[model samples]
Target: MNTRIGTIFAQEFRLARRNLWVGLATGILGLFAVVLGVFGAGQGAALDADALTLTAASLATLSVYLIPLIALLMSYDSFAGEIERGALALTLASPVRRWEIFVGKFAAQSLAVGVAILLAFGAAGAFLALSFGTGSEGIAAWMRLMATAFVLGSVFVGFGLMLSAMAGRTATAAASAVGLWLVLVVIYDLALLGSVMAASDGIFASQVFPWLVVANPADAFRLFNLALIETAPVAGIDGLASTLPFPPTVALAVLGLWLSAVLALGIRRTKRIVP
Candidate 1:
């Protein structure tokens, strides 16, 4: 890109590297992926499927719970922490546009997390490919898993940045990040299920439940990847995937929309940061 943004991106990436906790958390996730890939059959013979498919399934389950949380942890303090310490004032004094700083930091945080995911999935993929054969279909599925998983994570990176921009305090931003994760990944789905059960045969279950699942990036990510493998079912979630209101590609599109919308809000807030 242009020299200005490029410089900002490089600087931001360097700054992002200074945080080792992000690397450690994601490394632990990658370790889990490898463990799940290599030994998933121990869980049950029924689950003894293609290593890649099993890897994807196990990871889909794990990531919906972990990726968003980790993404939020990586980004929760991007602005608020700096601002809390009066560092943002010095940053604002610099010649760079506020939007550029926010965009650059966002890109850098995303890249840092993305690379960890790439490595995590890559290790599992290598094992799955070697054990299951390097057929195009299997390879394609693995690639799709990585892409979808990363998109799912990026949605929360945006979430974290938005919280940081709006909260203006590191503690508030951190707490909001965790709260948002619980709402989207856990409480939202549980509440939706409860509503469907409570309103069984009502228009809410018939007309709204399916759309509501797609509305949460977490659920959309879960269904899309489960559908991708056509798993031969994680606690019956494959059935949910089968019943997706929209195509799997549309879930990916929804994820893209979430990331874009949240990042836009973060950038707008950045421009208004007093210091």
Candidate 2:
């Protein structure tokens, strides 16, 4: 909010506008939105509750992968790349506080990705409205889906920024970001599946499964969006929805905690950057 942070934030957006990766990420999200919209409209199903449910499910499933990956890519270089190229040092030498730099960069990257999500999903919504007479419920559901995707993307941007701050070089930061993505997005689920199978009908599985799913931001995102639907696109987790400790609101709070915790850590770590 201060002049220094505002300047840094504006500078980040200006630089991001020219970044090829930002353009590519935005284009990919837009492409997915258009494709999904066209495919759903082509189904020619009446715009009823079931139709809205189906569309929500489809978008949630797609977003679980797309939003987080794009956010991670956009933020992986936030500090590492700047540090590698000496821009961070130059900026620190000025009157700016390190926290200002970190917060400014984080806010800028989040806004960029958030805007992309809005435009992409907005386009889809427009198409859907044109194809099927707009209804209040349908529009509300789409809006919820869009909001959830943006929050989910912000969580991963925090993750990427944390890695960028901790890693000493861009390559290391990028590698760490990709590895975290694999663990959270892919390997974690596989491991969870194995754990569930091994602990089948045991007290540990019954007591621990819900917490495990909630602990992972990706699973939380999926659960929060798919909570209303009877079936979930993610395998092996649908059955526990009824018994989960918290509701979608809690999952969203957990994601908020993720964004705050990681970004705070990143800011703290970034202050220690030498030269």
Candidate 3:
């Protein structure tokens, strides 16, 4: 809210926009959206009605991973990269508070990623409507998908900021962020599958497994989105046919706690670097 913070926020936005990678990533995602939309349209004619619904549901499900990947890419360099280059110290030496710096940087990164997602979804939705003449239900489903994607993106951005704040170098931060994504979005599920396979039939189906799955941010995102879009049955997730009661509210609370804690740690870390 202070002028100093506003200045830092503006600087962050400028840096993000000027970054070529940001531009490239945005363009690529936008293109992907258009292509997916076109595919959705083409499949409408040949596919049975129920099958088309499934396809849309699947695409919505896939967005859980898609949005987070994009957010991770945007935030991979939020803080550590500057520190690595020896610029972070000079930046911190300014009159602005460390929290201000973190908030500004987070906002800028979030805005950039949000824009990319909006563009992608808008293009995709428009194409689907124009090509297939999808009706009100289709539009409503897409809206739910968009809402879920936003939640998913916010979770990742918070996570990426935390990783960036803790890392010592740009490469380490980037690699760690990507590795975390791999584990959460993909490997974690595979590991769970293996565990279930090994156990076959037991209490594992109902008790600890459900709790363990919620602990995973990716799983939470998947469950929340799947629930929102009414596609949980399609995912064939046994036992967890839908997200638990109040899962969306819980997800938002958990994500906010993570973000606030990380930002606090980051500011503390920054303060120590100088004081």
Candidate 4:
């Protein structure tokens, strides 16, 4: 990392630490993790397949919504809010490159969210280990889930940053971020369900179903994490994975693409803003 970018990154981290909303949001997520972990411990022994499976499934389901929401809210103000408050002009007046500023902000926000996830899930894992001695298999599964979650959150951070760069007002950025979240997390699946029903046996369903799943980062994240469980049936996910044209590796690649494309576009968009 360039010295300038590193400075900006550190500054953003300090800002995030001081932000009351960021602290509150992380606390809520940590609370959820501890609660789920305790619930899983109560289900059976911590090492039990049923307990691990249930805990993973519940966490994956919750993350599909919560992670993205946190990512979006964390980043929706990155550029737009600064511009709205007239701070962006002053910041850009520095010797730093525009891309450095954008990249630094993105990295800081992503790291903040990742740390929150780790703290939350880590606490749960600790509780399980102390109380019931989590086995290697359970620990491994939890690690994989955590990785998928971090990737999922990065995807949305890129997406929300793009909106923040493009929108002229913080209000516009916030509204677009929330709307995009709803589309990707909720409406996308419902639309896919309708398509499946309409095309039942049509070639569209056969040929296009897998593409649809990978197109949405949330679905891809869900599929990637849920497919990791060796013994549990992950409700709506297993059926799709069985016929998924690509493997979990490909789903992860698609998410990587999403992050790259959105971040690149955001950088370019931010550079174009006159302020």
Candidate 5:
């Protein structure tokens, strides 16, 4: 099983690398890292240790959202594109089980995006080490940031694969993935914010907002990084501790749920394809 899955995953990764968006995202992430490092170095004198730690943590948190967007783009056409090109049927004619094909392909897609993020964070870590002269802690923090980014990315890529398996064409899959991403990562938060605003005087606003934030995978990733390694809680969420039970743990669990749900759906949907 391992050998079969590894073969398919290797092939899928090569195919994914040919996609223009994958390369473009990698380049953009590298550029962003360099630019962020330069900005941090330039502001070296103005900010102290605590402020620097906070800023780095905040930037790492932001990557939770940015990385997932790219991951979705990477896998949004995994199955649909092949079907559109009339190649999916031939590929399925092989001896591999559909579930293996689906899981292996999604794994490869997730790894490809993970590689991009790893490169970006590595560059950022080197920069911090050079500028701050405290490479130990900065490098450690970035390493955790990379792991968190990779896990968050897996959730998005799995969802994209599921969308691709369900859609009739690559275009439809792409549209649906983008729409879902926007809703989950942005609109959902905005809606929660609106609800909180409307109930400003109520207990729900003060008590339930943290739980609502956990529903957004991006926020969950941020909370995980901020609360755990950074030990710097999110700003302006003082009521969170009293309401949300184990915010970091819950966030991790929610992300795990998304990954499992999407991957399971993708595998089931792909198995049903006639090809």
Candidate 6:
């Protein structure tokens, strides 16, 4: 909230707004929200507690993929693209410290994506609540989803900026961003499954599997959100989540670690940038 940081935030937020990525993301989330609400309601069954839990499960799954992708795209070019266009050099010539620059830009990007998510989810949740009488618990669950989803976006914004700081070109940063998304959001769980299954000793699956899931931010995000739901979307994952050796709090802590480590590294790399 420093003056200089605020200025940078306003400037970057305008850029994101002008680019229409925010609008696009909001539209996508809103579309899915409507689909989920309408189809579930059309079945002639009022969405009681159990039905609402399934809906929560679905939203949690959607957040796992979409939020990270939105955040990464917003941030992957933060430094590298600016540097590529020589704006970073001019910004570097200013009196602001590297940390301030990263914080300002990341804050703006997070705010943009966070607003879009809340708007879409809020509208959808309200519609479902009014239409189906989801009651207090369902409202609270949606609120929780909004909170965790906000943090999840911050986690990936840090990731994208970290990669942005390290890459010399926007192309490299973009590629790295997408690959990181794929690895963490998609491939990590699959690889972990393979490792657990192949472990002849069975100790890995029993003792180490949960920890491994914690190490991946995407999995950690999913675990934290799903731990509260009775019927998780995936059969195998829900079984693990049921007796999830550690509570949802552990996954939340690991996500915090991810954000801190990446932000620190981003600042470190920013200090090294000649621009």
lDDT top scorer: 6
Best by TM-score: 6
Model 4 error, position 116 (Å): 0.5
- Residue 3's lDDT within candidate 5 is 81
- In candidate 2, which residue ranges exceed 4 Å CA deviation? 40-52, 230-235
- Report the C-alpha lDDT of model 6 over 1-275, residue by residue, as the tens digit: 78999999999899989999789888888778767766655442543344355566678777889999999999999999999999999988889988999899889998988888888888887777776666565666678788888888988998999899999699999999999999998898788888877889967777888888877887777788788865444566545777677878998899889888888988888888886
Q: Which stretch of 10 consecutive residues in model 2 shows the poorest summed lDDT? A: 44-53
Q: How many residue pairs clash per model?
A: 0, 0, 0, 0, 0, 0
How does each model score on TM-score?
Answer: 0.91, 0.91, 0.82, 0.92, 0.87, 0.93
TM-score ranking from best candidate downward? 6, 4, 1, 2, 5, 3
2 or 3, which is superior by TM-score? 2
lDDT per residue for candidate 1 within 10-129, as digits (tens), equals 876777677675567668877888787768645434754566776777788788898888889888998899899998888788787877877877777788778778887887688667
Q: Report the lDDT of model 3 for residue 4.
A: 77
lDDT of 3 by residue, 1-275 (tens): 78877887788778878885467656766676666665555555555432224334666557667777878877778777777788888887777787788778777777777676677676766766775676666676666666656666766876787788777678998999989989988888778877876886768856667666666666665555455545323544423636363455565455566556656766665455442
lDDT score, candidate 2: 0.79
| lDDT per residue (tens digit) for residues 1-275 in model 2 | 99998998998887777786567766787787667766765453543343444566678777878888898988898888988899888898898998988888888888888888888787767776776555666676678888988888888988888899889689999999999999998898889878888875777677787778878888788777777565333346655655666776778888888888888898898888885
**What is the TM-score (0 to 1) of candidate 1?**
0.91
- Candidate 6's error at 160, in angstroms? 0.7
lDDT of 5 by residue, 1-275 (tens): 48878998988888777765557777887776666656655554554433235445766656765887898888888889889888888888878788988889888988888888777666666666666565455556666677878899888989888899899599999899989888987788778877887885767765577778877778787776666543444554323433455656888898898788888888999988865
Candidate 2 total steric clashes: 0
Q: Which is better, 2 or 4, measured by lDDT? A: 4
